[model samples]
Target: MTNDDSKVGDIPGKRSLRPLGGVLAAMAVSLTGTRISVVALPWFVLVTTGSATQTGLVAFCEMAPYVVVKAFTGPLVDRIGPRAVSWTTDLASATAAAAVPLLHALDLLSLPLLLVLVALIGAARGPGDLAKEVIVPEAAERGRVPLERAMGLSGVIERLASTIGLAIGGSLVALLGPLTALAVNAGCFALGSVIIKLALPRSMGHTAEEASSPARKTEPGYWRQFGEGFTFLRGEPLLLTVIVMVGITNLLDAAITSVLVPVWARQSGNGATAIGLMGSVMGAAGVGGSLIAAVVAQRLRRRLVVLTGFLLAGAPRFLILSFDAPLGVVLAVFAVSGFGAGFVNPVLGAVFVERIPRPMLGRVNALGDSLSWAGIPLGGLIAGAAVTAVGLAPVLLACGIAYFLTTNLAGLRREWQEMERTGGQSVPEPSSKDDASRGNANLAT
Candidate 1:
């Protein structure tokens, strides 16, 4: 192996792993809170109003703000520093979430007010989440963690968080009611903000580009920074292709999670508890897959890992659901599907980290994530309507086939091939002057 390869292998020890530990802890706390709110908020809306449409509309309000704000805030994150953005916005989310239950108790809550509060929470969450994503590569580089390993670790954290959070959320809602769950969520977010603000080291505050840039003393205008991210993505076909693939899959996945699952549960004669259990099973499977990736991804080719994952993940759940399988069988199918999905994010994360320069990381990551997630609300809407019109089994089968074809066939494109071809070599760290110039360019339009 080359010296660079050796360096890659040795990365976990070069910088403090403490920062990664701190960041992941914060992420777990924040995500757990969010998951709890997901269950609690919808339950609150549905039980009180007795309207499924209203529940759907409330969800739409929350996600719309998330997609819109994240699309525009990438550059700001790059310019201002992710650390500041993460902590402050988390504070905002905590406040918004806390208000929902507190106002309800005070008899001051209205539907419109609740919708607006959830929207505010979504907006704050978008930037806060993006900031954390942008910081991952830098944190890895600083700690000498291999990019793939770091991203894999991130995926593991997310899966583990979701599993534990959803399980807890279900129990909380069942025992204490949704409002109490919301209150718990608020506390978690507040605590997460505190941990991130106080525990992380000063050196972890800035990107590598910022540390090396001499011109960093002068703050550029916002539009320029935004344009830079757009221009870079526009010029990179490989990046564009991956973004498109991710977006399509995200839309399909959203449909499965939000719409198809509930319909399937009802049709199969299982109640809401069974539906919740399906999620728990999938999440548990995902945690295992993510752990495997973190430990062994270096030995796998990125393209093959992604393609195989798509093949398994996209096909089985839909096929099983189409048969109106028993609840136990459905859970098993979804568990495998979750395993496949787990392989996806870490590889994709590593790819983005490797290709993008450090300075543009925040904007580009944010833009891509927002774009990919933008279709989630639409997915839920379309899936619900389609299931109602066409019946559950047919829609499930059709969507499953479409998802499988889209994800697997997209890999055949030439651009995807180019993106997957890594040379297994790491470039040397840039000198200070070069780093400064690169940083400036990365932030420029």
Candidate 2:
């Protein structure tokens, strides 16, 4: 049945929120650890090397593998099931993350060694993250929640993770050094691994193929499955357009967070505490915005919410920082930006889950996510070199202008007109290839 005919509580039997809660809890701890690294790792590289280029290189090493590995793992996630993939990868990531601090304490942590460790963490995180995204829809189904509200809750959890992670990260780096912060990150990953393994229902996170045809003998090859996802994505103009726009924005965001922000912290004499304070304030405001969106967003126009969110979320922070504004002024701009950002992912995620069929969810979602995130590795590299060649203010100014132009121009495209078509409920699997091709969707970075 189409979403219009299906209500949130339509499932006849008793619905359980346990599946959704487990997924979100796992997401929260893991994401919090990653956020802590966002603060601690860049600061660690910059202080240790005393070079912005090297700091950018460190980011490059981590994200390059993250994007590549995630792109290839979509079919594997679909075949082997997301649950097994999620736990195993989280465990691997925890091991790699823990190794960094342990090796450093022995004075054996060379720059090359550190890069290897972070790269390992990124590689493992790629599929680990994809598994979580793949499971959300099924979990939401088990919980009998609307897709929009589920995605909104996901956004809220993510924002909360960022607030807590950044605040603790900045404090730890400022007070006890980056190593202690990194150790905490490792512990968080381990805990998240345990949660996922033990908390979820056994029937959750299985492949759609398995659920639909367990007695079937034949299955498609890995490359064939990957190609199916690619072909389906290519047919959807709206999704393609969204991916392109998000790719550009993700690049700018990566540059700002990985290189520009830390450089600005050093130049403004604000130090690590300022970095933590700025991030936490923005994240705290984001939590408020996401909570509102979780409650009321289904009734709003997705297109308007997205365009407005981008208008507020993008450009302002870069411009504010470029002017060397007072700390309070900078934070005010960040809070506004963060609030706007809080509305974006929930809508986009709803669009994605509604358009793609359940069976193809893993592969299509992976390809869309990987493409949108394609430029992240280069963002820091380009920003770092540009800043070194000219200065921090000019680079920030240039990036801010670029961010404003790219987002607004993309909004003018006709495909975005379809953004409001989502019916606030889940779509069932399409019976034919052409039916699937007719569906529209959006993506986020």
Candidate 3:
């Protein structure tokens, strides 16, 4: 649906959700499509190739370009504006996604060709996803919505999309097969592109576009813009610490979802059904937790909520599986982890939004998020090798221990003190003077 509100200022003492809802519509669909791909792609490789190493290799091909391209595309998003970047990239992703099954139908698909297409999809998706995130603050502002509430709502949307996507993915893969699921994924990407291009007001994302028009010809170049984002990220110890810690966790998480769990499903003879069930249970619980956090997390102590969430979310599933726990216990651990994981991103999002100003959101977000996600590409590959070399239990144990140290032990550092103090705040728009001073600081540093 189209957004009815698009002005810069919020109505006094009144909240509007139309703008945020409009943005979330496209975002939610695209995210769901990604989750579905997470299911369909791996299974496709596993069954067609019957090789876990190849599965991990395919994942690495997709994510390596995804991380690198996204890191560099942030400046482009700021220069061209999120809406344009989002729609264009989504369209590109749709085309790439559709090509896969089409080629396979003609018996033209080969491993190298498939990897090439997957890489293209990942490259397009990086800019697409970053653009979507850049729009959140603008959407929140235009609707006059509270930043924390809006961010929390975004977290809820992600969880719900993930939940439904996994459920649908499992059923589709089990019944209709991965090709059918791949076709549906193509449709989602196309639909998300249309929604963003047509449903949002022309006035949306005007800030970024205006900042980079021909009249501002002397404005900082792309590399300079990227450098500023990097410098700012370097200066913020708390943000750096958080990114490093989360990067480790993201790596572990990627290994689990992409390699470990899929292998576990196959080895146990539970197959896709078990994989679907475990993911769906965790995702469903995550939705409930995200909904609760959306309402009350902004009011709680940030440090406690975040650490508790990590503690609950991290390590348990790995440990549980390592012990060869019963089905019910495994599911229970997944559920608890999902619930705790729900509180994490909302708190992190709020802290992120509170710290960065409007002007810096595009570049800084690109840099910071890319850095945190840097290890993800390697996760699947490493896990596959480890599983092959040392066996599953040992690999799982090492990852669990590493996750514990990265998240829990690292939290004791002084940088995390900032999380407690800045839990529920929103940043004001940066003025011209503020922007100038920041620009000078970037140059000086």
Candidate 4:
């Protein structure tokens, strides 16, 4: 029952933010590109190929490999180091991304070729993104920030990136066309790669000493390492619950982002401007909520915060769209949803970090996140087909209802109670004088 203030970092000064800052900067840069590609890629497929199905197929091609590659990349990260994996993967992604526009400009790009390029991007991004997340706890420890606050700030950075990226992506697609936006995305990935490759000191993701240790040499093979992660996940009911719930929601979100929103903009004759506007608004509100959560949420009961956040963040946007509501009302609903969504991840990140040991972080986190995101690849596909089949309103309504049930009902499990039991870092040892001082203060007070 010690307060959060009882903890402090052993690192000198606790003044340097470089480790954490570098990680965040890389995350921001890369994520911004991914978000832009989200808008631009689909638009490119739709406008060029004139097929929503093709768009979904391309999305599926990208994300399926993303999940699979990231799942297996974890062991290598623990062994070879996340830093090298991160930059190299980003370089691959950049090359793949650049080829799309280059080939298209040459008028030599076929649909099959486009799909291959998109898949390559997904494969590379999978590892790169995981590497960055893997770096966070290490960076946080080095900087002496509370794990929860660091996660909150991470959420803020992600929200900020998503906001700015979507805004810029939408604008670029509208004003300059999808190819230009794609070009910018390639540049972002390249820059992010450079930052991680050279900007941060060598100690961030894994130590060279650790990498060379006999224990490292003796570590299990890839499948065995993966099995360890799988076993860890299978044993954690809370983590499983979160993964399943998030998986469903992520699927729905993918549907919205990849198909619903873009289709809505096109059908409404509002085009890319409206899509960008909605994403920007939601991201902005999410940033505000993440900031507030970082400041005050640590003291609150975890289950309540999680449940309340789900209630606010889920269902509304889908329901609003289903109603064919006025744009103003839809925007308002999205804003509220974004705010509620903000409280969720920081809390989730804290719980996840506390529950897992450092050694197993990469594999476990990769598996968990990949599973939670398992449905993402299919999201666009399902939404595209559904909207094409029964029309948009029905699909939106079904998704909204499903989202509402999943978020609210899923929180009822006894396993979720685990969130409250976990403590941050290891408990500190209290010295004799410290105990004596505390007793004296208690008596005097």
Off by over 4 Å in 1: 1-14, 205-214, 421-423, 426-445
Q: State TM-scores per candidate.
A: 0.91, 0.85, 0.87, 0.85
Predicted model with the maximum TM-score: 1
Q: Give the backbone clash total of model 3.
A: 0
lDDT of 3: 0.80
Instruction: Tell me the tens digit of each residue's lDDT in model 1 across 178-263.
Output: 99999999998898898778656544535445566676767566887787788888987877888887788778888888888887
Q: Lowest lDDT 10-mer window, candidate 4?
A: 425-434
TM-score of 4: 0.85
Question: Which residue segments of model 4 deviate by more than 4 Å?
Answer: 1-15, 46-51, 106-108, 207-209, 259-274, 384-395, 421-445
Question: Model 1, residue 94: what's the lDDT?
Answer: 97
Q: What is the lDDT of residue 311 in candidate 4?
A: 86
Q: What lDDT does each candidate get? A: 0.80, 0.82, 0.80, 0.81
Tens-digit per-residue lDDT, 44-92, candidate 2:
8888889877887787789889988999899888777787788889989
| Ranked candidates (lDDT, high to low) | 2, 4, 3, 1
lDDT of 4 by residue, 43-159 (tens): 999999899779878978998889999988887776666778888999999999999999999999999999899989999999899888888776776676776678888999899
Show pairs that collide, candidate 1. 11-144
Maximum-lDDT candidate: 2
- Looking at model 4, residue 67 earns an lDDT score of 91
Per-candidate alpha-carbon RMSD to the true structure: 5.0, 5.7, 3.8, 7.9
